[model samples]
Target: MPVTDVTTDHEALTMTLTAEFAASVDRLWKAFTDPAQLERFWGPPGWPATFPRFDFAVGGRADYYMTSPRGEKAGGSWEFLEIDEPRAFAVLDSFVDAGGAPADGLPTMRVVFAFEPTAAGSKLINTTYFTSAEALEQVVAMGAVEGSTMAFNQLDRVLAGLREYSAGKGTQTEILDDTHVRITRLVEGPRHLVWRAHQEPELMRQWLLGPDGWRMSVCEIDPAVGGRYRYEWEPLEGMPGEKFGFDGETLLWEAPRRAVTTEHMTGTDFPSTLNDLTLDEEDGATLITLVIEYPDKETRDMVLATGMTDGMEASYGRLEGVLERVG
Candidate 1:
């Protein structure tokens, strides 16, 4: 169920989720075909999808839009294909700008949802395709794995609610794949300067956000292939946070170019997630692409639910501040 076993190259971030459900394939088919059921769980929670008009057919389409908190709008259309009743349905999807204009950032995802009739009920599965590996990574960063996982998980919960009325219990679990989630600051400085600041444990403790009395104990790196590394964060008295450390071996380390580290986590059933750092020098500055690959789609979704992206933006902001002050 590892969702993040992906390439650090933004072009290689594509992955898929597959799970079985104790419901009939036909029952699951309606969940997707029926607009009433879809509107309930479509488009990750909080930002609801408004299905203004839809016509489900071979050449039919689903037009929808989302309204952001700041009142900005995003709209898109879903084109259906090979719509076999109660068994298989395929659709091509894309993100459109406000007022239904096609945008360049998103790849046209080809999604195939299949329903398998089982002895108990139906097993639902979906496979999504990307135009390019980089296209997949772009969406992943934009929260593709998280968003799709959230949408399906929500749908599962919704179906479970309906199953209760049918005198049955729902049984489904969304498992996530190996993942890592952390902020890599992209600053307006040379890669060497930025790397030195980040590799410095003392500088990290000075600017990193923590409740109170929170400090970084170690910031060690080998910075070469076959190198092992570890870092620890300890919360002092009244810090209001748990202390943790990443004690994983580095799988790839090509100095100032790319580094991949395996992360270990306890206190949860799940264990390790993989993380990668790709440092690309752009215009004398480095575009540090930091990626966390989860062990499963479920864990990845959980990380997304925590709004880690916003936290990342915040963390990177701190990294910038530290760089400015130190410079």
Candidate 2:
């Protein structure tokens, strides 16, 4: 696969995200333009969609809400700018309130989504505009980049599995970069037990880190396309700890299977790594692969140079212990 390029224009507070996937451009088109399909994989499970009606033609409108999996409401609107079959789409991505009201400073900006055929598959380019540098920065801080990329990722998966999509679990995930860590753990335990450890928060917290005074502040997961999940950690007392990290990461999470995460750690000098974890049941055991993608080559180099592979083995040992215990 070709690389996903992210180019920024600070003066205009704009960003252009370009990437290719293993599917045809036409297939990718419908997932974005069709209302029914959009709702199907738009948010993680439980994300409330409000498209009283969907108009895909020029001058048509589409609106959606990301209700917390528990049903708390959040909304946004889109106005089609230009649509060229299987080739491109342009629109205004406006952030709207619960009452469907647009705000100032956070003005609606133009979004241009282009599709191009490639030998390997299809390429997608997302160009988004903003009014000012500060506004762009604020939106990035608000997690816009991660969210949009993740949503596009969902679209990629749905298109790839269109035949089975009508009955299959949508997209798994694709590596956006070659940076970060890669770990392949061979498990001897039953997959069901390992699956629970991955899906259940309480089981996850124990093996992923030392249980000494470690607390998980947030493990909320909706677990479906367009659903939301956040992992927040805080320090606890009565523990011997390194200058541990305090952090949180939230992004689109599809359940029982697929998801994307943007992990940001504070208090430690670690770079943000986009983490993707996948599972497959082999025989009676589970095959789990965790891939962490760093922002740049330098970050990746630093991580690898730190003997990260050995460290991961140690961590997986902890995970194995937990899985066996739970099993």
Candidate 3:
């Protein structure tokens, strides 16, 4: 985790966060000032941030929103108040309405981002000043601390770059808390091609097969929110394993970027899991991130213990070949 400490001073009506990153101060500053880099890890795990408007200079403004897994959106804005290159900057952060106006009665805060060089890399001291104790308490009640920590933890991956971080990782799995697990892989293709490999049924059938002896016997996909998809796999002749399938309803779908769905074992009594799939492209390669939300710790463990990561690695390896042939 990048966040080392979080201190909430009720008396001073302030919240301070201290984090260290294995990146230089210049790189850290660029990550904050650059809109593309900021959006990559600004929000918590499932909720992703997008900056529609970003003016980086002092006296400018930035408008952004975080979209939830189910496609709900919460908007926020930042008014740049001060700027010192590669060192510090401050902004007035406020909740905003859909029309980009400040939301009525919501508390605004002053946030200062201070960066400094450390022996290993760099450190960030982030302080948010609230107008009153009520404002500070309100955010805490809203899970700001937990959310911020999760958001900051993602920064390390962004700083590392997709290819540098996950090229040879081969379907990395991270148990994020009890109910959530994150799976990641880097595809050696552009974002659009990677999206198509998942979206198109023909392409999916070509590469979605988990292992060598199995084939995708059925692939019925509807690429829209609230649509349903069913996929089944069957073993080749003389193979040992039995046939299995999964069915799911799409909860959210954003072409070439994100898709969220509920997945359940077909014809079984197993509980469903929410899969939030997102793709980020950098330097002609796409990073595939899938965060699965299980109903409980037991479900999470049960699903992961089945060699899921290994299967995914095989499937993704096939996907790279599919992309190469189709590109």
Candidate 4:
């Protein structure tokens, strides 16, 4: 019900609706692009959709049908016109028959979905252009407005479920062994960009901070075996001059692929830890795996109890944004 407005222009034969969702741009993008997720909310309540063929790319086609409470089915198809990942897309939407042919006398509209990042989360603008005022009125009279509102409302619930799933997946901390803890995430962007973000001092400052209002003040890295690196952070406003820092020695370095280091945190009871990072690329995305080894199980448990996993997850979320900007 966060839909701000729904407007129709008779002269232009267009209808536009605006709504906002409490989800990140990337997550909403998945809701629209992923077939399984799309089906979960693409129809109004009590009228679920099933997509038999969905190809989410430029020039791709999608064939789907929605079922009514009485078991009647209405088929539709989408001819993708353009796509800009996590931003916008356009398609020709039309009614279809069971045999996969266009239904006679049904209006075909040009539809556009635009996504924008906002303070709350993301804003979605949906616009549909018809060939004539009659076509627009015809669809509107057929409950297009109410149906869309209900479908979007359903989307809100779907996004909420996705958030719950992501929080669990993103915050998962696995004990690989008595001395090792590992965390992994599939990041959006190429492997090289992810690697550079980890290696370069300037890029590190953008996302290395674990929480909001904290900034990295010092970041120095020598990317070579046996080289030394140091990073420091301080609160941006409160507790003037209070700081935390870490210095490390690189034991192994492989550009854009792997890194191994021994890290010692200053001003902490924790012991020095061995950190290993591995990056793998697949189809324009990267999977980053980070493993940290402690001296013993007690040290690992102690660090985990300090909410270190939550902080690391927060830092990883910021890194996703940095990758988008630099990738």
lDDT, each prediction: 0.62, 0.63, 0.94, 0.81
Reference-based TM-score, model 2: 0.49
Residue 191, model 1, lDDT: 73
Candidate 2 local lDDT, residue 27: 70
Candidate 1 stretches with Cα past 4 Å from truth are: 1-14, 161-327
lDDT of 3 by residue, 1-327 (tens): 899999999998999999999999999999999999998999999999999899988899999999998889999999999999989999999999999998997899999999999998999999999999999999999889999999999999888888787756789999989999999999899999999999999999999998789999999998788899999999999999999999999998888899999999999999999999999999999999999999999999998999999999999999999999999
Error of 4 at 203 (Å): 57
- Model 4 pairs in collision: none
User: What is candidate 1's lDDT per residue for 1-327, written digit by digit as tens?
Assistant: 212222223343335565566666766888788875676557653344668878999988898875432234677788997788988888888888766766776678787777777776666667677778777767777886676665565565446543242222111122323443433334555677666665566676665543335676766766554566677777776657777766666675445555566667534446676665544343455545455667677778776787555545555657767877877
> Candidate 3 vs candidate 4: which has greater TM-score?
3
What's the residue-level lDDT of 117 in candidate 4? 98
lDDT of 2 by residue, 1-327 (tens): 223776768887798888777777887677667775676446532232546557787898888876542235667788998989989989887888767778555667788989888887788888889888887788778766665565555454356443333223221222335554545565656656776776687886776553345566666655554445556655677555544443444454534333455566555567667666645443455546566667788887766677556555554567778977876
Q: Candidate 2: misplaced stretches above 4 Å?
A: 1-3, 43-50, 162-327
Q: Which stretches of candidate 4 lie over 4 Å from their true place?
A: 162-327
For all the candidates, what are their Cα RMSDs to the real structure? 16.9, 10.5, 1.1, 17.7
Better by lDDT, candidate 2 or 1: 2
